[model samples]
Target chain A: MTSDILAEAMDYIDDDLISQAYSYSRGRPKFSKPLAVAALVAVVVVAAVAAIKYSDAFITAPDSGDSSTTAEYFGGFMPDKISDGELEYEGTPFTEKEISTFVEKNKYDLIGAIAAEYGDFESVYKISTSGYSHVNLGETNTLKYDYVDLPVCRDDEIIAKITLFRSDGGLSYTISVRGKAFDKYNSIYQGNLSAELAFFYYGFEELIITPTNHIYRVHGTEETLEIDRSMNYYEKYATEYNTFSYNELTDEKKYITVKPLPEEQINDGSAYTSSDIEEETAEAPETSTVRTVNIYVEDLMSEEIASVEWGSGYDLMLDRPFRVCTEAQKSEMLRFIENMKPTEAAEPVQYYGGGYIVRLVYADGTRASVVLMGGDQVYFETSEGESPIYVDTNGNASALAEYIVSLI
Target chain B: MDDTSIIKLYWERDENAVRETAAKYGKLCIKLSENILNNKSDAEECVNDSYLTVWNRIPDERPDYFSAFLCRIVKNLSLKRLEHNTAQKRNPEMLVSLDELQECLPSDNLPEKSFDARLLGKSISDFLRKQKEVDRCIFIRRYWYSDSVKAIAEDLGVKEDRISVTLFRMRKKLKIHLEKEGFCL
Candidate 1:
């Protein structure tokens, strides 16, 4: 009986996939020309399609007027006759063949161009990965961000695929004009975030990673909540949040340090070391224990008030692709947030459908936004980090955000 | 009616091709389009247009593979709608999805060939077909279907972190495959 039911479900799912396949191919134009015209169009289309093989390096968004794409903005991939090892712009899922082809084609530029670019790039360590990549251009504030990507139909590796950004916005010089390009992969080391912790969206709370690699989950609430070696890491070892390593008690070294979030931390999923749970919990240090999180909340929602002290230890966990913020910076930001007055969030004017998100624009122009749907639940995200924070269903949305701001 | 019967009816120009096609694959198409377009009327229009387009083309062209053919038809129609409705932020289900795949591809121009688009199209399809059913379905749902993180979790009975990790890994796999197929660098 179960098998029969499963079969029916499978059939239904297959039919659905087949039906939805159309949506996957959205944005394609319908071309119905005369047979001869179609024949020509087909040739062109086919040729264009075949050009999917043209993997080239290109640059990504360079703020253009209006909709943002300019003709020159789309630079062509240099021929692949590499005399040296310069990073090549192969398409996503790059095959060795494409790289070889690119290398071979650009080789002629050898000592003259591309090789020199790679040489200069190689002079500095260039790292890239599936997620995002960064290059340390030294104190000069010269940094570049490279995004791995490709466009439709064109073989040469485009340069823009790897997004290069500097804290000082220094990729400003005529790039590639120097022809010194070397690319590195898997360079940035984002610390481990437990898969379990990955589930909670810290909303606006900042993740503080001490130089010792101990990660503190701090939220700037009306009071201030900072979890670290200060009080006790074992106290919350296994509660709404858990941390094992940083300050494992004597025999407690056996407690497996599991990141609260298993997924975000990748391989570090959930670790188990200690034999006794109760003992470890009871031995938490009281002095360093973080109680309140002072948040400099900029935006306060309707009917929500900031609490006076640390409330229930928020079960909130910071989500990754989180852009880690520093303590000093957080303090500066919180002060700015508290002085700000709460304004009525504009009624969501039919944004695509029902409601839109409320955006918080900081004095420095930094922005954080909270999207509250029907149930008053909040999903907080910022322009910098990749992760989003989810506020508790019962907590005051304003208090929750204010708390996070205070922590930031 | 079965899929084969609908194709036959479509070619015969019974004028009820749309109705019959809807009967056979309406919900399926609707759900799929809804997954991507997220609009009832737009999804309905896409399916109807697919039926109409199929009806007009089938009399002259007979396809050996019916499902793939219908899928391609609907897929093209949905793309067209996305382009037409660009005034608003009506991104198709694959907006962020395709972005994930972007990393694995060459960071340059898209490949150019006579049949490159179709080839890459075939490549994606084949790649998808090769994935484990549950994993593939997860990818399609999160991506092609535009299902939210919550929806995918509820339907699959798995944790959201699992889905997120799975997606990240899946994109990596696709990226690796692209390198094998020699698509991007």
Candidate 2:
């Protein structure tokens, strides 16, 4: 079940992000015209979309029951003029046919952008994905599509379909602009059409189309007081606290040498030479054992602590080093440990909330460990038994927990 | 006045800081509290409390992001107020948002491990940075601001269904990401 930790975690999001949310709410662009593009792109039936082959791209029109769109003005596709690897946008090579195929395949909802005042259209050398609604097809003159639709983004790839809708079926061309253009166009357009052409673009603004939303329900409870206790622990401590892993054994290694028995000595108790024993010892597998134990809170309350090592998880798996705690803080923690009263409890199955394992090293090279769970409960790892011996610290659980977390 | 100016006033122990902060962010704080409490009076009271808390804490503690710091305090106070409210008085909209986020939790009972809220927050921010701007905007609006799906959709000029669908997909991705990050639900 989701705990308050998740909500608390939201509070911990980068301050700038929280500020960005405010900006989004305050700076959201208000569009003047009302568009009725079906909201759910996933459910929207692809209207009897007819592809009008214009230049190298296929200009698909929503089944607007007009039959007068198939004339010389609606330039047909030039199969022979299909350029091969001639244009590239955002590292993705797009041939004339490829662009047509992409637009046709996705069947992206198209918004009509009526190109105002077309000049001499020369060879299509490059497909610019810049934000400018006006594209220089060739000469100094720019082909301005007053109304621009926000690009459809698919996995970081922006493929925007600009359908050049012309009155009188005047060479209706379709151009594809992909990649970084989406951000650029979105910043400029801000969901508003160009106000320069209020006459033609006014009523046409209702054709603005939005991208489809793909459905995916991908993967969270509370329970009794015990569960609530666990929930409280998780919600309160899991997110607010820091955990440390305690490596119980010191890094010092002691090598031990073992000599194999002589073959004859095994059956007849024959004496083996010291040189032979040395040779066997040299050939034996080298064995090294950890020589020192870290100080535990239980065993070394009176002893001076040399240092402390901590890890995030229980299995001594270190994620990051614990922040250096002051000597006074260490003494205080030791005092808390001394004052802690042993309490009866069930076997420590799992904290299922939050905790850290702390290993204390004494000045005399001895070591001990204390498992701090949910701030209130402490477990002294004095034995290799199945269950941990739990301890209660009266009503100072939160203070102890805070102290433990602070040590991180 | 800007946030820095207001913060400066706080440092100078000038009471005008509270007034300036209220003038600038009172509406936002009230809106945020209202989203959670679903009670205008309660929301206003929480905002006032937040202002007092900020007034008391500041000068001693100067936040880098003054607005966000205030927002966090206000949100915490609002949630606390909601907790104290009776079930009948609780905001169902806020509960719905929380319930929806609950769905993002790990489905399988992986052994619970202690997680740093800051670390998780970083992970979430990283995930959001990789998302589309619109998606990220929608997410922060709904989760951070506690905005309803319809509200988010209206703000973004999209359908509520679209917002719902996008949220669903994002929640799924988040669950997967959290699982991969070794976080237990």
Error of 2 at A82 (Å): 42
Error of 2 at A381 (Å): 63
lDDT for residue B146 in candidate 2, whole number 0-100? 88
Model 2 misplacement above 4 A? A29-408, B108-116
- In angstroms, give how far residue B57 of model 1 lies from its true place: 2.3
User: TM-score of each candidate?
Assistant: 0.31, 0.41
CAPRI-style class, candidate 1 = incorrect
Give candidate 2's total backbone clashes: 15
Computed on C-alphas against the true complex, the DockQ of each candidate is 0.03, 0.18
RMSD over all Cα atoms, model 2: 30.1
Cα RMSDs, all models:
26.4, 30.1
Quote the lDDT for A131 in model 2: 19
Looking at model 2, give its docking quality level: incorrect
Per-residue lDDT of B64-171 in model 1, one digit per residue for the tens?
Answer: 656556655666687678667754546444455555545655554442332244455456556767654445666666655556665565443334554565566566
